[model samples]
Target chain A: MELLGYLGEGFATSLMPINILIVMIGVTAGLFIGAMPGLGSVNGVAIVLPITFIVPPSSAIILLCAIYYGAMYGGAISSILLGIPGASTAVATTFDGRPMAQQGKAGLALIAAAAASFVGGTISVVLFTLFAVPLADVALAFGPAEEFALVLLAFTTFVGLGGDDVLKTIIMICLGLVLSAVGLDLISGDPRLIFFDQPGFYSGISFLVLAIGIYGVGEILYTIETQKSAPQVTPAKITFRELWYGLKEINKLWKTMSFGSFLGFFVGMLPAAGATPAALMSYGIAKLLSKKPETFGKGAIEGVAAPETANNAASTGSLLPMLTLGIPGSPTTALLLGGMVMWGLVPGPMLFIEQPDFVWGLISSLYTANLFAVLVNLALIPLFVWALRMPFTVLCSLVFVLCLVGGFAPSQKLHDVWLIVGFGVVGYVLRKADYPMAPLVLALVLGPLMERSFRQTLIAEQGNMMAFVERPISGTFMAIAALFFVLPMLKHVKRLLRRDLSPAE
Target chain B: MITGARGKLRACLGGKVETIMLTADRVLAAGIMVLSVYFMWHASALPIGWNGMTGGPGGGAFPFWLSGIMFLCAGGIVLRSFKDSAPFAKDDTPFFDPDTLRSVVVVTLALTATVAALPFAGAYIAIPMFLLWYLKIYGKHGWVLTGALTICTPVFLFFFFEVTLKILLPKGWTEPWFFPLYARFF
Candidate 1:
C-alpha cells in the first residue's frame, strides 16, 4: 500500500505537461541519434548533457533517462534495416534481424523488435522499482570503509570479467586515477600534479571533458576509418496487418522474453557485463532452447525478439546501482552519475531519504519513457529510413561542431577544449590499439570517491589498516574484490594445466 | 638447417616482420611508461607516504603508487609484445589503410583548426567555416544543402545557448557584434 502510494505520487509528477513534453522530445532526439551507425546512447547523452541545463535538475534527469531508453529501442532499427548495429548493445540484433530483413520481412522484424523492447523495458522497470528501496536501505549502512571496498570491487570486475586485454585495462585505470588526483588534494587542501604550471590544472579534469572527447570526438574519428562506404538501408513499410501478426508471433515467445528479461536484469547490474553481453547471452540461450534452433541467424523471428528484449532490459538494469548505491553499472550510467553530481542531486542512499519526490519522479518517468520510446520507434520507421540515407559526413560535421561547442559550454574554458582535442586524438589511437575506454571513464568518475573514503576510514581508525576488514560489510566487499582480481589469473592457470595434459594425452 | 630453425623460431614468435600494429603497440606501451614516470615525479612533490598526523596515506600517496603500478603494467605489455607468443606477433594487420588514413587526417586537422579559431575568430565565424569545408568541399554535397546548414546551425546555436540557456559562447573578436543581440535578449 505504501509502495502503491509512492508510485501514484510518482505518476502525478511524471504526467505533468512539461515533463511529458520533455520526454517526447528527448525520445525523438535519442531515436535519431541511436539510428545513426556510429553514435549510441553515451554519445547522445554526452553531447546533449550540456544543453540540458535550461530545465530544472529533476526534469533534466528525466529527459536524459528518456534519451537512454529511446536509444536502446532505436539501436535495433539500423540493425534490422541497414544490417548495421546502431550501438554495441544492438550487435546481437544484427545476427537474425539482417536475415529477416533480407527475406523481405523488414516490417515484421521491426515490429517484433519494438514489441520485444517494450516487453523487456516494462518487465525490467518493475524489477527496478521493487529492488530500488531494498538496495538503498542496505546501502544506507555503508561507511567510508564499505565505500572504498565497493569502488575497488567495481574496478576489479572490469579486469576480471572484461574481454579487453588485462594489461591495457590496468594501465587505463591507473591513468584515470592519476588524472583525477591532479587538482587540489582532498585531505590536505594543497595543490598537486600542476603540470607545466597550467592554471587549468588547479580545477582538475571533469568527467564531461573525457566523455565528450572519447565518445564524441574520438568516436567520430574512429568511425571515419571504419565506415568508409555507405550501407544500404532496407526500406521498411509497416502495415497494421503485419503489426498485428508480429504481436501474435511475439506473444507466443513469452518464455524467451521473460527469461531474457531476468537474465539481462541480473547481468546488467554487474559493472563488467552490461547490455552487449546480456543480449548476446540471451540470444544464444534462446537458440539453444528452441526446437528449430537451425533457423536462428537465418530469419527466425525469435532471434530478433530475444536480443531486442534483453538489451532494453539490461539498460534499465544498469540504472539500479547508480541510483541506489552511487555506483554506476555501465559507462552511460557513469555519465548520468556525473551529471547528477553536477546538478547537486548527489545520487546515493541519502538521495532517497532527502529527495523522495525526485527519486520517484525519475522512476515513474522511466515507465512513461519506455512507452513513448516504443510508440516513437514504431511510428518513426519511415522517417529513420529516410534519415539514415543522409550522408555520414554531414552527421560527422555536425557532431564535431557540437563537440566543440559542448566542450566549451560547460567550463567556458579554451583550455578544456584543447584537452578534449588532445584526449580525442589519443583516445582514438588507443582504441585502434585495442585499449578499452570504459574502465578509464569509470575510474575518472569514481576516483575522488575512492580516495576520499579510503583516507576518511584511516583518519577515523587512527591509521588502523585492518579496520576495513574488521567491518563485516566492507570485509565481504574486499573479499569479493580479491576474488574478481584473481579470477583471470585462475583461468590462465587452468588453461596452462589443460595444455600440459593435452600434450601428454 | 640453421636457416630453417630461424624461420621456425620467427614463425613461433609473432615474427621478425614489422607490421604497423606491432610498431604501434610497442610505441604506445613505451609512451605509457614515460607518462607514468612523469606522473610519479610530480606526485613526489607532496608526501607520497604515510602522514602520521593525518593517520593515513598522504595526498600524493594515491597518485604516486597508482602511477608506479601503471608503469609496471605498461612494462609488462612491452615485454609481452617481444615474446614469440605475444598476441599481435602472430597476426599482423596495418594500423590504418592509406586512403582512410588520409581522410581521417584531413578531418582531424579541420576539427583542430576550428577549435583553435574559436576563441580568436569567435564561434559564429569559425563554426560555419568548418561546416562549409566539411559539407561543401570535402563531402561534395549540393551547394543548397551546404549553404542551408551553414546558415541555420549558428542561428539555432545562438538562440539555444545564448538566448535560452544564457550561457554565452566565446565570441572573441565578434563580441562587439553580439552586443545588439544581447541588448535585446537581456
Candidate 2:
C-alpha cells in the first residue's frame, strides 16, 4: 500500500508536462539511434549524457531511461528490416525477424516485436517496483564488508559466465580498475598513476571518456570496416488490419512472454549477463519448448516475440541493481550510473530513502515510456524506413563530431578529448582480440566503490582478513564469489574428463 | 610446446601460413604485460604495502596488486596462445584484412589530428574540418550532403552548448569571431 502511494506520487511527477515531453523526445531519439545499424542503447546514452546537462537531474534521468526503453524497442526494427541487428540485444530478434521481413511479413513482425516489448516493459516495471524496495531494504543492512563481497561477486560473474576469454576479461578488469585509480588515492589523497606526469592525471579518468571512446568513436571505426557496403532495407507497410492481427497473435504467446520476462529479469540482474544473453536464452528456451520447434528461425512469430519481450524486460531488470545496490547490470546502465553520480546523486539503498520522488518518478516514467515507445514506434514506421535509407557516412561523421565535442563538454579539457581518441583506437584493437568491453566499462564505473568498500572493511576490522567471511551476509556473498571464480576451472576440468572418456568409448 | 603445436598445425594444413591475428594475439599479450609493469612502477609512488597502524593496505596496494595480476594473466595469455588447443592458436584469419586496416588507420589518424587541433584551431573550425574530411575524403559523400552537415553541425553545437547550456566551447584564435555572437546571445 505504501509502495502504491509512492508510485502514485511518482506518476504525479512523471506526468508533468515537461517530463512527458522529455520522455517523448528521448524515446523518439532513441528509436532512431537504435534503428541505426551500428548504434545501440549504450552508445546512444553515452553520446547524449553530456547534453542532458540542460535538464534537471530527475528529468534528465527520466529522459535517459526513456531512451533506454525506446532503444530496446527500436533494436527490433533494424533486425527485421535491415536483416542486421541494430544492437547486440537484438541479435536474437534477427533470427526470425529477417526471415519474416524477407517473406513480406515485415509489418507483422514489427508489430509483434513492439507489442511483445510493451508487454515485457509493463511486466518488468511491475517486477522492478515490487523488487526495488525489498532489495534496497536488504542492501540497507550491508556494511563495507558486504559491499566489497558484492562487488567481488559482480566481477567473478564476468570471469565465470562471460562468453569472452577469461584471461582477456581479467586483463580488461585490471586495466579499467587501474585507470580508475589514476587520480588521487581515496584514503591518502595521494596522486597516483599519473602517466607522463601530466596534470590531467590529477582529475583521474572519467568513465564517460572511456565509454564515448569505446562505444562512440571506436564503434564507428569498427563499423566502417565491417559495413563496407550499404544494406537493403526491407520495405514494410503496416495497415490497421495487420496491426490488429499482430496484436491478436501476440496475445496468444502470453505464456512465452511471461516466462521470458521472468527469466530476463533474473538473468539481467546478473552483471555478467544482461539483455543480449537474456534475449538469446529466452529465444533458445522458447524454441526448445515450442510446439513447432522447426518453425523457429523460419519466420515464426514466437521467435520474434520471445526475444523482444526478454530484451526489453532485461533492460528494465538491469536498472534494479544499479538503483538499489549501485552495481550496474549492463554497460548502458553503467553509463547511467556514471551520469547519476556526476549529477550529485548517490545510488544504492540510501537513494531510495532520500530521493523517493526521483526513484519512483523514474520508475513510473518507464511505464509511460513503454507506452509511448510502442505507439511512436508503430506510428513512425514509415519515418524509420525512410531514415534507414540515409547514408551511413553521414551518420558516422555526425557521431564522430559528437564524440569529439561530447568528450570535451563535461571536463572542458583537450586532455580528455585526446584520451577519448586514444582509448577509441586501443579499445577497438582490444575488442578485435576478443576482450570484453562491458566488464571494462562496468569496472571503471564500480572501481571507486569497490576500492572504498574494501579498504573500509579492512580498516574497520583492524586488519582481520577473516572479517569478510565471518559476517553471515558477507560470508554468503563471499562463498558465492568463490564459486563463480572457480566455475570456469570446473568447466575446463569437465571438458578434459569428457574428452578422456570419449577416447575410451 | 610452442614449436611442437605449430608443427602439428602446420602439417595438418600442409604448411598454411599463420596470419597476422596469431602474431597480434602474442603482441597484444606482450604489450599488456609491459603495460602492467609500467602500472606497477607508477603505483609504487604511494605505499604499495599494508599499513599496520591503519589496519588496512596502503593506497597503492590495490593498483599495484591488480597490476601484478594483470601481468601474470597477460603472460598466461601469451603462453596459452602457443598451446595446440588454445582458441586463437588454431585460427588462421588475419586480425585486420588490408581493406579494414587502411580505413581504420586513416580514420584513427584523422580523429587524432582533429583532437590535437581542437584546442588550437577551436571546436568550430576543427570539428567542421574533421566532418568534411570524413564525409568528403574518406566516405566520398557528395558535396551537397557533406557541405550542409559541415556547416549546420557547428551552428547547432554553438546554440545548444554555448547559448542554451552556457558551456563555452574552445574557440582558440576563432574566439574573436564568436565575440560578437557572444555579445548578442550572452
Candidate 3:
C-alpha cells in the first residue's frame, strides 16, 4: 500500500505538463545523441548536467532519467544498421543484429530489438518499484562503518571482477582517488593538491570537465585514428504487416526474452558488472538453451532479441544499487550520481525517505520513457539510420565544440575548459594504453564519501581496528570485500603451487 | 639478448611503428610508480589524523595510506611488465600513427587557443573561430559548407543554452558591446 501510494503521487508529479514536455525533450535528444557514434549516454548525460543546474530538481530528474533509459533503446539502432555499436552495451547486439541487417531483415531486426527493449525496460521498472523502497529502508540503518565497508566492496569488486587485468584497473582506481584528494580537505578546508596557488586548484578538478574531456573529446581523437571516413548506411523501414507479425513473434519468443531479462537484472545489481556482461551472458545462455545452437552467430532473430532485451534490462537494473545503496553499478550511473550530487540530492537510503516525490517520480518517469522509447524507435528507425550516414568528421567537430561549451558553462571558467582539454588528452592516452576508464570515474565520484566514512568510523572507534568487524552489517560487508580481493589472489597462488608441485614442472 | 627482446616487441608493434612503443610497458609502469610517490609525499606533510582528535582522522591519513597501497600496485605492474606473460610486454605498435598524432597535437592547440580567446573574444566569437579551423584545417571540408556550419552553429548554441536554460555563457571583456543584443533576451 505504501509503495502504491508513493507511486501514485510520483505519477501525478511526473505527469505534470512541464515534466512531460521536458521528459520528451530529454528522451528525443538522448536518442539523437545515442545514435551518434563516439557520444553514448555517458557523454550525452555529462553534457546535459550543466543545464540541469538551471531547472527544478524534480524536472531535472525527469529529464536525466529519460536520457538514461532512452539512450539504451537508441543504442541498438546503430548497432543493427551499421556494424558500429552506439554504446558499449550494444556490442552484443551487433554480433547478430548486423548480420540480420546485412541479410535484408533490417526491419525485422529493428522491430524485434525495440520490442525486446520495451519488455525488458518495463519489467525492470516494475521490479524496481516493488523492491527499491524496501532496499532503501534496510540501507537507511547503516552507520558510517557499514557505508565505508560498502564503498570498499564496490571498489574491490571492480578491480577484482570487472577487468581482464587486475593491476591496471586498481592503478586506475587509485589514480582517480588521488585526483579526488586534490581539492580542499572536507573537514579542515585545507587545499592539499594545489602546489600552485590558484583559485581553481582550491576547489579541485571538476568531474564534468573530466567527463567531457574523456568521453567526448577523447572518443573523437580515438575515432579519428582508426577511421578516416564515415561508412554509408541504408535506412531500414518496417511495414504494418511486419509490425503485426512482430506481435506474434513476441509471444513465441517470450521464454528467451524473460530469461535474458531476469539474468541481466541480477548481473546489473553486481557492482560494476554492467550491461555488456549481462548481454553477453544472456546471449550465451540463449544459445545454450536453443534447440539449434549453431544458428546463433549467423543471423538468428533470437540472438538479436536476447542481448537487446538483457542490455536494456541491465541498464535499468543497474539503478538498484545506485538508488538504494548510494553506489553506482556502472559508469553511466556514476555520472548520474554526480549529477544528483550537483543538485544537492545525495544518493543514499536517506534519498527515498527525504525526497519521496523525486524518487518515486523518477521511477514513474522510467515507465513513461520506456513506452515512449518503443513507440519512437518503431516510428523513427529509418531516421536514425539516415543520421548514421551523416559525416563522422562533422559529428566529431560538433562534439569537440560542445565539450568546450559544456566545460565552460558550469562557472564560466577558462581554467575549466583547459581542464577539459588536458583530461581529454589524458583520457585518450590512457585508453590507448588499455587502462580501464569506468572504475576511474566511479572511484572519482565515490572518493570523498569513502574518505569521510572511513574517518568517521576511525573516530567512532577511537582508532581501534577491530571496530570495523565489531558491527554486524559492516562486518558482513567488510568480509565480502575481503573475499573479492582474496579469492583472485588465492586462485593465482594455487596455480603457481600446482605448477611447482607437478612432476612435469 | 636485448635486441631479441626488442625484436619481439617490434614484431608485436609492427615494424613501421615508433620505437618508444617497444619500451612503453616499462615506461607506463614506472610512470605510475613515480606518481604514487608524489601523492604519498604530499599527503605525508598533512596531518595523518590519529583520532576524532587531531582534526578528525587528519587530512593526510586517507591519501597517505591509499597512495602507499598504490605504490605497491605500481610495483606489481613493474614486475609484471618484465615477464613475457604480461599483456603489453610484446606490444610494439605505435600508439597512434604519425598523421593521427599530428592531428591530436593540432586539435589540442586549437582547443588551447579557444580557451585563450574566451576571456577576450567571448564564446560567440571564440566558438566560431574554433569551428572554422577544425572544419577547414583539421577536417578539410570546403569553404561553402564549412562557412555555413561555422557561422550558424554558435547562434543555435546561444539560443538553446542561454535563452532556454537561463545559464549565461561568458560575454567576455566586450560585455558592453552586446548591450543592445542583451536587451532582447532578458
Candidate 4:
C-alpha cells in the first residue's frame, strides 16, 4: 500500500544516525524536564526549541516530538513518587500512583506508569498513521465558513464539556477571546484595541507568553500556597522481574486500559478537549465500570494505569488536528506548530501532500520515541525516584527561576516577564476561586484563528450571516454547536419544571 | 446557614472586624465586569462592522462582537458570584490570614522588583538578588544554602542558555561585565 511505502521511507529518515541520537537526547531531556515540578511538555519544548533551530525541519520536528512524548510519559513519575503532577495531564495519576508509592509498591507503580504510557502512545500512533492523511484530505475541502463553524464548535465543547462552572467558564473564555482581540487586525493593518499607541500593542499577546505565565509561574505560586513536603522517599529500583510483574498485573486491567486509550485518543483529537479532561474522564469511567469502585484513589493499579495511559494517548492524539488541519489541539502542539513554522514548514492540509517526508518522519519517529521512552523509563526508574528526593523549598524556588528564564527566552523582552508575573497572580487567583484555566487558554490560542476565519467567511459571503449554517459541512458543525448551547439550557429548564411539578416532601 | 457561606465579609484592619462588604467572588466578578465594559467601549471606537470596501470587515468587527460577548458574560458572572459558595467564593472566609498576607505581599513585591530590575541590573544580578532575598530573607534558610544557590544559579544559566544554546540574554549596564564571558562563550 502507499501507506506502507511512505512509512518505509519515514523509517529510513528516522533511523538515520543523527536523527536517532537526537531522539535519544530529546527523550532523556524531556524526562528530566517533566520530572521537575511545574515543568510540563509546553515548558520543555519552549525551553529547548532554540537548540533545534540548527537542525533540518524533519530532525527539528523529530526532536521536539520526542521531547513531547518523553515529557508526557515523564509526567507520571512525579505523580507516582512525589504526589505532585509535573504536568496538568498527570494530575489524575497522583490519586492512585502516590497511594501506591505510599504503600511501598513504588517500583510497581513506576513500571505500571511506563508500560501504560507506552501502550497508549503506541496505539494512538497507529491510529494517527492510518487516519491522518484521510482526515487532512477531508479538511482540505473546507472553506472559511466551514472552518469558522468548526472552530465555534470547538469553543462550545471546550466550555460546555470541559469545565464545572458554566458561567465562570464562559466568562473566562470570553475574556481570553477579547484579550486576543487587542491588537491590529490580520487583514486590515488598523489597530483594534491598542491602549497607548505602544509598538508592542501592534503584535498580539503571544501564546508562549500566556502559557509560561499561566502554567509555569502560576503553577509555582499555586504549589507554594498548598505546599506539602514530599513524603520520605526510599530509592525503589525497577528490575526486569518487577517490570514484568507490573505489566502482568496491568494485563488483567485491559478493559480500563482500552477505555483510557480510546477515550484519550478521541478527546485528544478534539481541539478543545485535551489530556487533563481525558485523564479525568477515563478515571471517572473506570471507577463507574469497576466492580470495586471504592478501590479507585486507594492505590488501584487500574487507577494508576488508566490516567497514565490516557494523558499520553491524549497528548499524541492532539497532534492529529495540527498535522492535518493546522489547528493545534493542545498548547504543546501549538508550540510545536510554532517550531514547524520556524523551520519554514506550514502545518495544514497541504503539509501532508507537499512535505511528506517531515510529516511521515515525525509520525514514524513517534513510534520509535514511544518505544525508547518505555525502555528509558524502565531502565532509569531508580534515577527518576531520586528526583523525588528533592526538598519542596528547593523545588519551589528552582521552578520560579525556570519560569523566569523560560518566560524571557522566546522574546528576550522584559514585557514577557511582567506578563508572566501578572498572569501568574491572575492564574493563582483564578485557581483559588475554582475557575478553570483550560477554557481560557484554549480560547486565547484559538481566538485569533477564529477571528480571521470569521472575518474571511463574512467577506467571502459578502456579509451574509446565514452562510455559516448554509454550507453542508459548516451547517452540520453549526447545528452541533447550537446543540451544545441548547442541551444545557434544556437540562436547566427540565430541572426547573420538575421542581415546579413535584409536591413538597 | 452556618456552613460559612452566607455571611458578611468583614475586614479586619488590625484584629477588629470592620464594616461588612461584598464576597470575594462578587468583588472579583464586579471588577472583571468593569474591565469588560472598558474593553468593549474601546473596541466599539473602530468601525463596528463591514467597511463596504472589497467585502472586507472593519478592523474592529471581530473584536467588537467578542467584546460584546465578554461584556454579557461578565454581567452573568457578577450576578452568579453573589449566589456561589465554593471555597474561594465565600463571604466570610478571610482572603488571607495575617501571616499569609505578609508572605504574599513580600513574595509579590520581590518578584515585581526582580522583573523591574531585569533591564537595569540584568538577569545575572537581578536573579541572584531575588533568590538571595527569597531564600534567605523570606525562606529563612541557612546562609550556606542561600549563598551557594545565589552564586551557582547565574553560572548555570550562563553556561546553559549562553554557552550552549546561543541565546543572547539581556544584559543591562553590566552588559560590559557579560562581554568578557560572552567573548569566552561566543
Candidate 5:
C-alpha cells in the first residue's frame, strides 16, 4: 500500500508539463549523441551536466536520466545503420544489426531493437523500485576501510577485465588517476597539479572536458583519418506488416531477452558495471549457447535482441544502486548522484525515510520517460534515418560544433576547450595503438572517490597499513582482491603446464 | 652473402627513418611527462590548509596522491619508450594517402585554432565559424545544411545555457554590442 502510494505520487510529479518537456528534450539530444560513433552515455550526460547545474535538481536529474536511457537505445540505430558501433555495448548489436542492414532489413532490425529496449527497460525499473532500498541498507554498513577495499577491488577488476594488454590498461588507469589529481586535493587544502596558479586547476580536470575530448573530439579526429566516401543509404521504410514481423522476431527470442534482462539487472547492481559490459556479456553468452552459433555474425536475431535488451535493462539497473545507495554504478549515474547531492537530497539509508516523495517521484518518472522514448523513437525513426542519409562531411561538422559548445557550456571557460583538443589527440593516438579507452575513463570517474577512501583510512589509522586487515569487511575485500589476482595466473599456469605435458603426444 | 648485405643496407635505411619517428614521439611523450611532474610538484607546493573532516577528506589530500601516481606512471611511460627496441612500424598500406593525413591534420588544426580563439571570439561566434569552415570547406556540405547548422547552433546555446539553465556563457568582445539584443530576448 505504501509502495502504491509512492508510485502514485511519483507519477504525479513526473507528469508535470516542464518535467515532461525536459524528458523529451533529453531523450532527443541523447539519441543524437549516442548515434554518433564514440560518444556514449557518459559523454552525452557530461556534455549536458553544466546546463543542469542552473536548473532545479529534480528537473536536471530527470533530464539526465532520460538522456542516459535515450543514449542506450540510440546506440542501437548506428549499429544497425552503420557498420560502426556507436558505443561499446552496441558492439554486440552490430554483429546482427549490420548484417541485417546489409540484407536490406534495417527497418525491421531497428524496430526489434527499440521494442526490446522498451520491454527490458520497463521491467528493470520495476525491479529497481523493489530492490534499491534494501541494497542501500546493506551499503550503509560499509566503513572507510571497507569502502577503500571495495574501490580497490573495482579498480583492479576493471583493469584486468580489459582482456587486452594488461600493461596498457594499467597504464591508462594510472594516467586517469593522475588526471583526477589535477584539481585541489579534497583531503588537504593543497593544490596538487596547478601549473599557472590558476583557480581553474583548483577544480581539477572537468568531466566535461575529459568526456568531450576523448569521446567527441577524439571521434572527429578518428573519423577524419578514416574518412571515406560512405555508401549512399536508401532509407528503408517499415510498414505495418514489417512491424508485426519485428514483433514476432522479438517473441521468438524471448529466452534471450529474459536471460539478458536478468544479467543486466545483476550487473547493473554493481558500481561502475553498467550497460556496456552487461550487453557485451549477454551477447557473448547468447552466441556461445546458441544452437546455430555460426549464424550469430550473420544477422542472427538473437544477437540484436540480447544486447539491446541487456543494455536498456542495465541502464535502469544502474539507477537502482545510485538511488538507493549514494554510490553510482556508472559515470552517468555518478553525475546524476552529484545532481541529487547538489539538490540537498541525501541518498543512502536515510533517503527512503526522509525523502520518500522525491524518491518515488523519480521512480515513477522513469516509467513515463520510457513510454515517451518509445513514442518519440517510433515517430522520429524516419527523420533520424533521413539524418543518416545526410552527407558525412555535413554530419561530422555538425557533431564537431556540438562537441565544442557542449564542452564549453559546462564551465564557460576556454581552458576546457584546450583540454578537449589535447585529449582528442591523446585519444586518437591511443586508438591507433590499440589501447582501450574505457578503462582510462572508468578510472578517471572512480579515482577521486578511491583516493578519499584511501586517505581517510590512513588518517584514521595514523598511517597504519594494518587497518585494512584488522577490519573484517575490509579484510574480506582484500582477500577477494588477492583471489582475483591469483585465480587468473593459476588458470594461465595450469593451461600452460597442461599443454606442455599433453600436447604433441 | 652479397644479397644479404644489400638487404641489411636497405634495413638500415628503413630503421633510421623509423628511429627518427620513434625519437620524436618519445621526446614529445617525455616532455608531457616532465610537464605533468612539474604540475604535480607545483600543486603539492600550494598553501592550502587541511581542516579535519570526518567523511570528506580535505581538498589537497586527494590531489597529492593522484598526482603522485600520475607522476609515477608518466615516468614509466618515458622509461618504457626508451627501453623499447622498435619505436615505429611502417604502414603496409599506401604511403602517399593525402586524404587520410590531410583530413586528420586539418581537423586537428581547426580544433586547436578554435580553442586558441575561444577566449577572444567567444563560443557563439567561434563555434559557428568553426562549423562553417568544417562544413563548407572540408565537408563540402550544401549551403542549406551549413547555414542551418550555423544559425541553429547559437539558438541552441541561447536556449540551453542562457535561457533554460541560467548559466552565463562567455560574451567576449561582442558582449557589449550584443548585450542589448540578447538581454531583450533572454
Candidate 6:
C-alpha cells in the first residue's frame, strides 16, 4: 500500500508537461546518438550534460535517464541494418542482425530488438522498484571496507573479462586509470600531472573528453582505416507479415528472453556492471546453452534476442545502484548521478526517505520511457534504414561534424577537440591491435571511484589491507575476487595439462 | 625461387601486402608499449602527497599505478610479437588497399589540422573554414550544401553552447572584432 502511494505520487510528478517534454527530447536525442556508430549511450549522455546545468535537477535527470534508455534502443538499428555496431553491447546483436538484414528482414530484426528491449526494460524497472529500496538498506549497512572491496571487484571483473587477450585489456584499463588521475585528488586536493597548470587540468580529465576520445574519435578512425571498397548495404523492406513473423520468432525464443533479462538484471545490480557486458555475457551464455551453438555466428534469432534483452535490462538495472548508493554503475548512470547532485538530491540511503516524490517520479518516468521507446523505434526503424542509404561520403562527413560539435559542446573549449582526436588515434590503434576498447573505456569511467574507495579503505584501516578480509561483506567480495582470479588460472592449467596428454589418452 | 625484377617488385609491394600491414601493426604496437613505459615513468615522477588528517593520496598515484600495469602488459605484447613469426591478419582481406589508405589518411589529417587550429582561430572562424574545405574539396559537395553547412555550423554552436548553456568559448582576436555582433545577439 505504501509502495502504491509512492508510485502514485511518482506518476503525478512525471505527468508534468515539462518532465514529459524533457523525457521526449532525451529519448529523441539518445536514439539519434545511439544509432550512430561510435556514439554510445555514455557519449550521448556526456555530450548533453552541460544542458542539464541550466535545467531543473528533476528535469535534467529525467532527460538524461530517458536518453540512456533511448540510446540502448537506438544501438540495435546499425547492428541490424549496417552490420556496424553503434555500441560494444550491440556487437553481439550484429552477429544475427546483419545476417537477418541480408535476408531482407532488417525491419523485422529491428522490430524484434525494439520489442525485446521494451520487454526487458519494463521487467528490470519493476525489479528495480521492488528491490532498490531494500538493496539501499542493505548497502547502507556496509562499511568503507565493503565499499572498497566492491570497487575492487568491479575493477578486476572489468579488466579480466572480455577480449581475445586479457593482457591487452588490462593494459588499456591501466591506461584509462592513469588518464583519470590527471587532475586534483578528490580527498587531498593536490594537483597532479597538471603540466599546463590550468584550472581545466586541475579538475582532471573530463568524462566528456575520455568518452569522445575513445568512442567518437576512435570510431571515426576505425571507419577511416577500414574503408569498405563498396558500401555494404542492402535495401530491405519488411511487410506486416514479416513483422508478425519476427514477433513470433521472439515469442518462440521465450527462454532466451527470460535468460537475457535475468542475466542483465543480476549484472546490472552489480556496481560498475554496465549494459555492454551484460549483453555480451548473456549472448555468450545463450551460445553456450544452445544446442546448435554453431548457429550463433550465423543469424540465429536467439543471438539477437539475448543481447537486445540483456542490454535493455542492464540499462534499467544500472539505475538501482545509482539511485541507492550515489554510485554510478556506468557512464550513463554517472551523467545522471551528476544531474542528481546538481539538483541537490544526492543519491544515497536518504534519497528515498527525503525525496520520495523525486525518486518515484524518476522511477515512474522510466516505465513511460520504455513504452515510448517501443513506439518510437517501431515508427523510426524504416526511416533509419533510409538514412543508411545516404551516400557514404556524405554520411561520414555529417557524422564527423556531429562528433566535432558534440565533443566541443560540453566545455565549449578547443582543448576537448584535440583530446578527442588524440583519443581517436589511440582508439584506432587499440582496435587495430585487437585490444577490447570496452575495458579501457569502462576503466576510465570507474577509475576515480576505485582509487577513492581504495584510499578510503586504507585510511580507515591505517594502511592495513586486512580490513577488507575482516568485515563479512568485504570478505565475501574479496573472496569472489580471489575466486575470479584463481578459477581462470586453474582452467588454463587444466587445458595445458590436457593438451600435454596424447590422443590415445 | 628466382624471380624477375618486376615480379620481385610485385611480390614485395602487392603479394606481400598482408605481411607488410601485419608487420607494421606489430611495430606500432611495440612502439606504443615503449611509449606507455615512458608515460608510466613520467606519471610516477609527479609530485603526489596526502594532506593532514590521513587524506587520500593525490591524483598522480592512480595514474602511476596504471602506467606501471600498462608497461607490464606492453612487455607481454612484445613477447607475443617475438613468438608469432608469421603475419596475422584480423580478417582474410588485404589490410590496406592504396585508395582506402589515401582517403582515410587525408580525412584524418584534415580533421586533426582543423582541431589543432581551433585554439588559435576562434571556433566561428575555424569551424566554417574547415567545413567548407572538407565539403568542397574532399566531399565534392555543391556550393549550396557547403555554404549552408558552413554558415549554420557556427550559428548552431554559438546558440547551443554560448546562449543556451552559458559556457564561454575562446573568442580569440576575432572576439574583439565581432564583440558588437555577439553582444547584440546575446
lDDT of 6 at B76: 62
**lDDT string, candidate 1, A1-505, tens digits:** 7877888899999999999999999999988988899788989998888889999999999999999988898899999999999999999999999999999999999999999999999999999999999999999999999999999999999989987888999999898889889899998889999999999989999999999999999999999999879999999999899999999999999999999999999889998889999999999999999999999989999999999889999999999999999999999999999999999999999999999999999999999999999999999899999999999989999998889889888888988998898899999999999999999989999999999999999999988999999999999999999998888899989998989889664
Mind listing the fnat for each candidate? Answer: 0.87, 0.84, 0.49, 0.51, 0.56, 0.62
TM-score, chain B only, every model?
0.90, 0.89, 0.77, 0.77, 0.60, 0.71
Give the per-residue lDDT digits (tens) of candidate 5, residues B32-87.
Answer: 56755665566456432343444334455454555556556555554554433323
Interface RMSD (one decimal) of model 5? 4.3
Q: What is the TM-score of each candidate against the true structure?
A: 0.97, 0.98, 0.94, 0.90, 0.85, 0.85
Rank list by DockQ? 2, 1, 3, 4, 6, 5
| Per-residue error (Å), model 1, residue A325 | 0.2
How do the residues A1-505 of candidate 5 rate in per-residue lDDT, one tens digit apiece? 7677778888888888988898899888877767766667877776666667765777788888888888888888888887777777688889899998899888888888888888788888888878866776777788878777876765566544535444455556667776777766665455567657677776778655776677777866777676566754536677889988888878887888888888998887665467878998999999988888998889888889899889999988878866775556766776676556646776666787787777777888789778877767766888777776667777667667767766776676767767788887888877665556766765676676677777788777876778987888889888876675565567778987998999595
Instruction: Work out how many backbone clashes candidate 4 has.
Output: 0
Q: Kindly list the per-residue Cα lDDT of model 6 for residues B68-185, writing each as its tens digit.
A: 6677777666555433232354345445556567876787888887776667786677777778877899778889888988888788777776788766666666778767766876
Q: What tier of docking accuracy does candidate 4 attain?
A: acceptable
The reply for model 2, stretches above 4 Å from the true place, is B1-16
**DockQ of all candidate complexes:** 0.79, 0.81, 0.51, 0.47, 0.38, 0.42
Candidate 6 ranges with C-alpha deviation above 4 Å: A50-54, A92-107, A196-200, A229-256, A267-306, A325-356, A503-505, B1-61, B84-99
Error of 2 at A130 (Å): 0.6
Candidate 3 lDDT, A1-505, residue by residue in tens: 8788998999998898888888788888788887776667887887777767667877886788888877888888888888778888888888888888898888888888899998888887888888898889899889989998999999889866885567878887887887788778877777686645568877777777778878887877787776655665746889999898877777788999998888888788776688889998989999999988898988888898899889888888888889998998888888888888878888889998798888988889988888888888788877787788777768877888888887888767778888888888888887877888888888888998888888777776777777778899999988988988877788889999998999982
- Could you tell me which residue pairs clash in candidate 3? B13-B92, B13-B93, B49-B57, B49-B58
Residue-level lDDT of model 1, residues B1-88, one tens digit each, is 4454456457658655655687689889999999999999999998989987777999899999999999999988877776655657
Task: Give per-residue CA lDDT, model 2, range A126-159, as digits (tens).
Answer: 9999999999999999999999999989999999
Candidate 4 share of real interface contacts: 0.51
Each model's lDDT comes to 0.92, 0.92, 0.81, 0.79, 0.73, 0.74
TM-score of 3: 0.94
Candidate 6 collision pairs: none
Candidate 5 Cα errors over 4 Å, as ranges: A1-5, A269-273, A291-294, A338-354, A485-505, B1-36, B43-99
